[model samples]
Target: MERFNKSRVILMPCRDYDEEEIYRQLQVGIRLLGGLEGLIEKREKILLKPNLVRKAEVDRAVITHPAVMGALARILREEGYENIICGDSCGIGTASRTMAGTGMERQMEKYGIPVTDFSHPVKVDYPQGHQAKQFVIAQDALDADAIINVCKMKTHALERVTGAVKNMYGCVCGLQKAKGHTLYPNAESFARMLIDLNQLLKPRLYLMDGIVAMEGNGPTSGDPVKMGVMLLSADPIALDAVFCRLVDLDPQMVPTNVHGMQYGLGTWKTEEIEVFTPDGEVSMEEAVSRWGNPGYRVDREKYGKNIWNALKALKIFQKKPYIVEEKCRRCGICVESCPVEGKAVTFKNGRENIPVYNYRKCIRCFCCQEMCPHKAIEVK
Candidate 1:
């Protein structure tokens, strides 16, 4: 297989979402990657795919920072890339609402870029895929000539950490994302499908907003923690591997990084990847010593396919989502997001009651937890 020269990843020190500072760092990162002239064309329709998981205030760290997206848009427009648009298929609501709720809509409007509707689904066939042969992605994403992934750095209930690679799942289109959780159901299988999706879309660049990241319960509904850095790479796996090192987690323990290497998507090996900063290239040890957060809260456990993952008696061995009655708004977003055919989570007792889950039918997909707006659902 022909492998990409995805060895170099740049980490820029950025403590906050200052647009000018972000623009300067982004320019430096792009220059370090041999510049945008060679990577994307001005005539191509570019899609800015951000990790807009759902609507939340910027300070909440629930979605990619609007400042980062704004800075990138400015860079692209200044470089003569006028054919640009931005969007993401969120967990529960329409893409427009998520973007608007996150303040991304206003930011894009400043740059005269329109938001793309991700409600339209288009199927693409990939017979050579290792795990999935077909994907029904957002029409805008499929139609884009090139994509620039702007992802958030955060922990995820099912995937451990949701970074560059996992962010692409947003392209799966509205309810299909919920359905995908039911289909793959496990970390490894879901990751393989993500890898296949990346292979199919082939995003041109990846930029991660790590200055402010979510820890503990995340991808949504987590506390904001500062990592004080921004990351850039053409390789999603390598970018995510660097994320792992900074958080003091083992890259091999992440299913996407492991399968990403096995399937020739990108390399996570410390020896194979080179990390850079404004000063120069640094050893992984030095990089970790300078920036690594040993105290960072994230799931570092290795997930494997076993009978215990399915059996109700062995539920302790598995992470199951439960409703926290105090925080639940009883809006039923959790029940609505549950993809199980018969509805694994439902307001069986009454509409006035908090939604309940049938453990026997639950797939442990964390859909309910992920879509819960009030931080009412927790996995344990």
Candidate 2:
């Protein structure tokens, strides 16, 4: 197993999303990874998989900054890499809506880049999978000549941290994501599925948007905190491991990277990684010393987590979604997002204004909470 395959993760201090500056730094990052030509080819199809999970303002740091996407596109075009397409299968909403809300629509229109909704997928087998024997992924992701994962750096209620490895979950498409949450409620099983997805995709490059990251309960619901750094890598697991280290979090506690290691994805060892910054390469100790303890972080806990997660998965125990009566707008978005057959949550008296949750039928997937526009849903 070449899990320790050496790769470079370049860190650049980028404070703002000025287009020209982003373009310049991206080039520097690419050069550190042995130049774009070394990773990509001339006139090949490239997919930019950004994390635009739901409708949100760009400054909220819920999605990849459009400036970063735009600048990367420009650099790719200049390097003769054409036919660049962007897309993601969001957890809470449609890709089109998310892209539009995250200011990606404007950039896509400006650059004449097409947005694939990732609604359609083809089933693919993964014989080595520990959790998933097979997977249904967006066709465009499979068809692309090369994939460049433009991931967001954030805290997740389940995965501890969402970085390069967890970003691939966007490939699962539509309601399958919810189904996955229902099937593998525990972080361990869920992370195995994530590792399988990444292994199947085998993206050529990974770029993390860490300029402004989310802390507390995140991936969807969390507050934004500025870390003001850009991370570029060819190894997804290594990239995630480094991120965990920088934040003074345990890489092993992060399920995606932990399962990724068990399955021979990439290195988690600090000594195995060679980190490059604008100035030059730095030792892992130096890198951690400078970037460790960002003041605020999402702590990953593992004590009795697997057992609790097992109970949650079996429905022996569940954290059901509750609607804040005052905050509920009666939009029916939560009802629509629910994957349950009869729908786990519904409107009271068919008034279409207030929401009602049927606790018994609920899968505890948290799709409603993940999708709610008004922050009206709570899991209790």
TM-score of each: 0.95, 0.88
Judging by lDDT against the true structure, name the best candidate: 1
- On residues 11-113, what C-alpha lDDT tens digit does candidate 2 reach at each position? 8768878778778888888887888887778777888899877878888778888988887888887777768888899876677887765567888777777
The residue-by-residue lDDT of candidate 1 on 13-77, one tens digit each, is 88788889999999998888878988898899999999888888889898999999999999999
Candidate 2 local Cα displacement, residue 316, angstroms: 8.9
TM-score between candidate 1 and the true structure:
0.95
The candidate that achieves the highest TM-score relative to the unseen native structure: 1
